[model samples]
Target: MNKLKLSGILAVIALFAMASCTQKKESNSPKNLQIDNKILAQNLAQKFIITDGHIDLPYHLKSMGFLDLKNTPTLVDGIKGDFDFPRAKKGGLDAPFMSIFIPPALQKTGGSKELADSLINMVEHITTSFPNHFGLASSPNDVIKNFKSGKISLPMGMENGSPIEGDINNVKYFFDRGIRYITLTHGKVNEICDSSYDPVRTWNGLSPFGKEVVLEMNKQGIMVDVSHISDSTFYQVMELTDVPCIASHSSVRKFTPGFERNMSDDMIKLLAKKNGVIQINFGSSFLTYKYEKRLKERDSLKRIFMKENNLTGKDSLAKAFNTKWLEENKLYADVEIVADHIDHVVKLTGIDHVGLGSDYDGVGNSLPTGLKDVSGYPNLLEELLNRGYSEEDIEKICYKNVFRVWNAVLDHAGKNN
Candidate 1:
């Protein structure tokens, strides 16, 4: 009748059910399993700090048409399905690199600079409004110091390179403003280099301007992100930067090769050689091969339709159906898929060069059930444990590897200590 009574009765029923199943099959052979404390830790280390390399909260704040960014919970509600402070705190996300995403379309005019300004303003708003909850960090030391001071570090990273607006000096300008990393392009190619998702050819690999961007970012101690660049472009980037570059939100090409989302085995090995980390992305489309292929196929069909109907510009076509499909299959991807990639990277490049980058709020709605947001990080720890990862290894994947890389970039960049 009461809560305790109800719980005990349910437990008896569950035990009886399990006993019946075991009675039916006299085998301890393993299948799909749901593990509890004997197999999982109830109170894992609270001091085990995990840093997510990517979370697009600032961009979502601006684009979601919200004026007040003061209340984090309210903003989380507005996201409908993205991240928030409470969710992140509960999820063990100690350090989150908030992407200062400048949309690719905005790069055409002075829009790049305008977008950068707006995004940077959002970062300022987060720090100023919520000082106790967040702090702006420039280097890995900033992250450690901020975290130890009882505040979460919300560092800024330039997601798209168009923000520099062709001026290499501004790369240093961003790094001075606590911007730690920069992705060369977005979904579309920019003045600097070709896009991995876009077919249009701007430069075969890193263009002359792109070369300068890499060199300058390396010198400024900003980590170069090669997530959205083509395979040719990735190799070219490897050649350009003396320091290591990160695939901040990417997975293994062993899962999906044709899709530009994941990197090849060769790339992984090379990334290790430079002491770079491949933070596995948790997007369902990127994790599932069939879903990724289906989305690409749907988009290709839509392109053909666009050409056939003499469509001049973009409006409201059914081009984004793959997005809908991804939403439907979001459940198929779980912590196991995430662990699988981490395991592969560890096996290929050792555990030092693999990490977690949720890519939250950037992709469409297709996240694993447990790893749905910043709050769901414990699920990853649980999976890694099941996969036989040591506590030290888990902590490394959580943040140490990336932190080490960050520190390495700082030393390599020859920044003033």
Candidate 2:
């Protein structure tokens, strides 16, 4: 019984070991790990209250002529923009700061305040029109309350300070009207500050009135947004403001070199030092220089094509040509690059300073591959989990970091008042 029985026992042991090894390998395989991470990411997205620093739904609605109460139902899913009730719910977007965007042209057109008021009114109308689906949030507490009640919070952040209309009192007025943060300027210098996109650099920084506006904003408990302001304006505002400021929809300039619209590495660090968050934008151009370079080339070619064909951009032929070119070129950045921007911020500052601020609707058709709409947030969170981000870190990136700044602004205002 000795040799035969021993060989049989050894074979059984070997078979058991092989089975265990195979099971372990299957569990740890890349495909299984990705699926596990995807599930975890989706759970984290819904478990935590996700607050996107900026979403251009209000402006997008106005442009589409769907800002009226009669057309409000379209926002449930009938519209074409990146944000809608169904998509926001699917993505677990609890609080998305609705951009009350006042185009710079309005600053000269003598109707900045009116346009801002109208946009704010439209947001209010949305909340009223769909009470169960939306609520207006003026503070972090409001967001929390809305989240608990299963309502999406529509906080307001003015894209340009043009609505202040040269009146210091309008700062308080806007705060009362639920403008939580205000980007000093956009695409051009305004009475408040110089825009990064403006070549003129009108004030070289904040105007004398701009400094007053910043202080007024602080006193009113409004977070000053430095997203589109010039570098000089940023530095000056940082020196003047008492509370932490946010770059609501800006990404890191390190990724897209020479794009002042995105914050620099040094700027991110400073923002972190003040306990502020830089919500990373998901636009392809904001994620990498390649996209910007390709965009420039595409624009140049389009101009040449238009000229050669004697067609305007609005012409159907030119539109078709542009669409076809984009389809063939396919230069969009993927979700991984967006995670890279978040990683860059986490490395330069910390996880507390980075948050999501997908410029939906505002970025046109240049959103990154997996982040093409509000519903794609889970994809980014899955990437973050795969890259070794913990649930706590994801929560901070999702909402807590921004809430800290918002609460601080409120506390400062309370003490001064």
TM-score of each: 0.81, 0.92
Tell me the tens digit of each residue's lDDT in model 2 across 1-417. Answer: 799999999999999999999999999899999999999999988999999988998888888776564656467754787988888888889999999998999888889999899899999998987899899998888999999999999999999999899999999999999999999999999999899999998899999999999999899999999999999999998899899989999998988889999999998999888888999898888889999789889899999999999998789999998789989996899999999999999999878888988989899989988888888899999999999999999999999999999999999999998
Superposed model 2: Cα runs more than 4 Å off: 1-18, 67-70, 299-324
Residue 59 of candidate 2: its Cα lDDT?
A: 86
Q: Which stretches of candidate 1 lie over 4 Å from their true place?
A: 1-42, 67-79, 293-331, 415-417
Instruction: List per-candidate RMSD values in Å.
Output: 9.1, 2.5
Q: What is the lDDT of candidate 1?
A: 0.78
Q: Report the C-alpha lDDT of model 1 over 1-417, residue by residue, as the tens digit.
A: 999999999999999999989876654333323254213432342467678888888778777664245444453233465677677766767788888888787876567777777677777777776788778888778878987876778877788898888889998888887789998898888878888899987798778999999988888899999888888888988887888878888888888758775888898999899889999998877777866565566567667776887664454554344356446544357878888888888999888999988899987667866787777787778777766787888888888899888888899878543
User: Model 1 TM-score?
Assistant: 0.81
